[model samples]
Target: MTYFVTLEGETYEEARESFSWDVPDGFNAAVDLVRKHDDGDRVALHQAFPDGRRERYSFDDLDRRSSAVANALESLGLAFGDRVAVVVPQKPANVLTHLACWKLGAVSLPLSVLFGTDALRYRLTDSEARIAVVDVSQWETIREVAPDCPDLEAVLVVDGEPEIEGGTVGDASVSRFETAIDWRDDDHEVAETDVDTPAIVMYTSGSTGKPKGVLHTHGVWLGHCPAFSMYFERDLEGTYWTPADWAWIGALGDLVFPAWHYGQPVVGFPMGSFDPETAFELLAEFDVTGSFLPPTAIRMLMDVDDPADRYELSLRAICSGGEPLTPEILEWAEAELEGTVVNELYGQTEANLLVTNCREWFPAKAGSMGKPVPGHEVAVLDPETGERVGAGEVGEIAVRRDDDPVVFAEYWNDPEKTAAATLERGDGDGQRTGVRSESDGMPEGQAWHLTGDLAERDAEGYLWFKSRDDDLIITSGYRVGPREVEEAILEHPSVAQVGVVGVADDRRGKIIKAVVQPAAGTAGSEELREEIRELVRDRLADYEYPRAIEFREELPQTTTGKIRRSELE
Candidate 1:
């Protein structure tokens, strides 16, 4: 429960030398985040609903409720390694659902609450989720979507009205959250899983134009410890809050679970959407001290005139990522936030929090991505030969995968894609969890996981991000796969060819733009454009729909018929 990393000297190098990653052979995320911290009176979460309702949940409440959920899932025939879809937002039910899954040794597959029917169907089908725990808003849609998901046997609806009776919805059984767990015993036996066991399967946009699942092991939490403490400079004893959705690794791994692991309270507001004014109110109201705010969110906050004077705040540390923090944003935050420091953190869904800034220990270079986080090795590697590039030379950012607990187990079941991004192994340093074994699904080879992000390392070891090497789009901190959007647009019969690109924006870091070539002899019209926009919004996510759509006579493509996104950009 103590701070994961220790800081003895006033230097990043000294901090790195002083820290070590220690995880026991027998591990379970439920034990670490909830059960072990179950002191009946200590507050674990402070939740606020938009309806003016507020409540505090103790660790005791969480342990009992999560155990009851575990028992309920077992009664429904859930077994070890079964995937359960958690499609709720910041509600206590969302966290409880994850804890319940880990306790039963089931994998938690989280999907954004903003996803539409098409987005929901893909993840549920690909993960083969046996049950989906969703908010009431999705109940009507899930009723229509469940028949297409073969493994879906039940839907547990949260926050549903009494009239929304629990019964058979299509072929899947429907049950109310309270009705299912209220009578179950809170002493269900927790599965004794290991550090390497599969825990979370988070879907992310990939270069191949599909949303691939990034499977992280139970050790993933331990892998994030060093960076979490470092990012905040060990200033995490107080309450934590983040506007980031709990489904994101930046929120779940960086803030929520880590805060609980340290026996600290986390404030939860299902804000429904982000409003800078509302965010300030919640931050001041709860006395939150730590958070993981994305740079794009920070930009939105900057537009609020004088936040420090307008609201009483207690933020000691704020970690930012997704896009580089511009100098103007950093300067504004430094002067306005008083004591809080906005540190840039680097990592993707596959290997997160690997690079960070601890301004309390060492001065960070302006416009630099800080330094490699302690306990994790980061380097600029030549993409072709997999050799370390010299200083000041641009190369792909990569992290050693050999026994690195932060490296994902695999891209769900796509071993071919996994092998493509991984570099051949080098000798083991034995720092991360343990040595890689074929039993671990990967052998000793493929030691480096190529991030596909271009960057350069300075002589002082600070990394400067260059650009993304693929067609993926990061808009307002959400990673959107251009391919996913294009595929959705292609589903429309009027669209013959499509190209999706991310254009720079002042407010959102990037905005999605789709260029379309109408089907043979089909002329594009305003009605067709509106219809296409509606199709994307219905099939993908509301946040992922193209902001601008253009009708083109032809789209530039490679010889293989792949849309040339570079030309579109």
Candidate 2:
């Protein structure tokens, strides 16, 4: 009765029938990612620089450095469950900090380097980490935020030399990465942790206006394996990379852990910001064979026509999430990227990698999120009753929480919010699946975590993303999902990025409006605007087409690179 796929599957049904979860009593993130995999000189990562330099780090290098940093942090009074804020780009130091924190049984909170001073201060103050590992560029600013983060006691600066006698800055101790760990022995043992022991806390992109910390356990690694395998396929080769920021679960769970679990080297190429040309360069230069490209990245990559003719690329598999993978882009990837297949993934920080499409196992539907991956039950149900809706009807996606290892431990410290994610629904033929929260939970509810997304399941079992509950537009009597309209407009060559939202209207309750960022050298004009409007009208319903179109050089995006639809107004 099991439908679990072992990391490699010849057929979807065959794989699921043989799949299972095996989280052991004694589990450690460090041991799983670095300890057992390291054969001393096996390269673990390749850190690429903007200056065209690349440095390789072996498993032995990480093992030695992480153990030393673990001991150093422990000496500074960091204990089990203590949070360590790791603020850096995709670099060796960032990986080392995470491994070290896990080795000491501490929670690693990864914040993006793209975050400004205010965003950095907010996360530091909120997570209340006892220590922080930051880049040298942020050493001076860390002191400015230290007063606001009273719980933070130590700051380890990467790529900088310690300046002070005792390495003290304000109320917190500050020392360089090497200086802090140089005095400690590099042979410390990893902490013995349970499958349920908390490991990492990642903040959501806050597309809803406020960010919340999502805490996950050690079992998450086991939970991510099957889908990762499904998306990347068997016998992973060459280097794995993702343009997604390393702080997000898209990179950490989908690429880093899964790639490292197979002992494949990951490219930590932080280009400061995502550039389509630079991304192509890194993939070619490093011979990257597999990657998880975000939807935006793939869309931008489409701008380069005849890419197969332009550069030499080793990419064979590319899995994308964080946005819908429009058919236009998928077609472009398949046609121009040589052998790359773009499999779409669907999940949030709360529940990573729940659904995926596997190469050769099945044919991908245009813009479909694919079926639920092996090891998960997925259903589209009514938001209020949790009853299964008939095929072709939209419903909130929900995941069964009882014994679900991939579900996060809790919303960091917010019990009400954590409890809010789960609900008691009538268990009338309930299936495991993957939405937004309902205000009132029925008293006699079965445990199900809502994903806050709206989607429809076809008779064939493929699910298509409609829009976030908050982003759904109601104009007159017709209902519209912004994504449906956005995808239509994106098919037009001139459009690069767009955010669709419903604005208040006098005649209709709200009218659809699209704020678009055109392609480079393309101007937003009346003729172009009409073409975008006509494109949507021809593709989707007239109600879904934007009544108004505004042009801009850029759109507001969350730190994680998701468009902020709430800000479109």
Q: Which candidate comes out best when scored by lDDT?
A: 2
* Candidate 1 lDDT score relative to the true structure: 0.79
lDDT of 2 by residue, 1-569 (tens): 11222554578887766766655567777777777763658888888998888898887778888898888889999999999998888888888888888888899999887777788888887888899988877777776777888888988888876464257665788777777776348888888887688989999998876789999887776678778887876647668998777888888889987777667789988787778889888888888999988888887787777777788988888998777677777777778887578899898889888888886788888788887877765667676556668789998887766666788888977888886666554433333331223332433444777787889999987888888877888999888999889888888888888999999999999999999999889999999989998899999977778889999999999977789988898
Question: Number of the top candidate by TM-score?
Answer: 2
**Each candidate's clash count:** 0, 17
Model 2 accuracy (lDDT, Cα): 0.81
Worst 10 residues of 2 by lDDT: 431-440
lDDT at 119 for candidate 1?
77
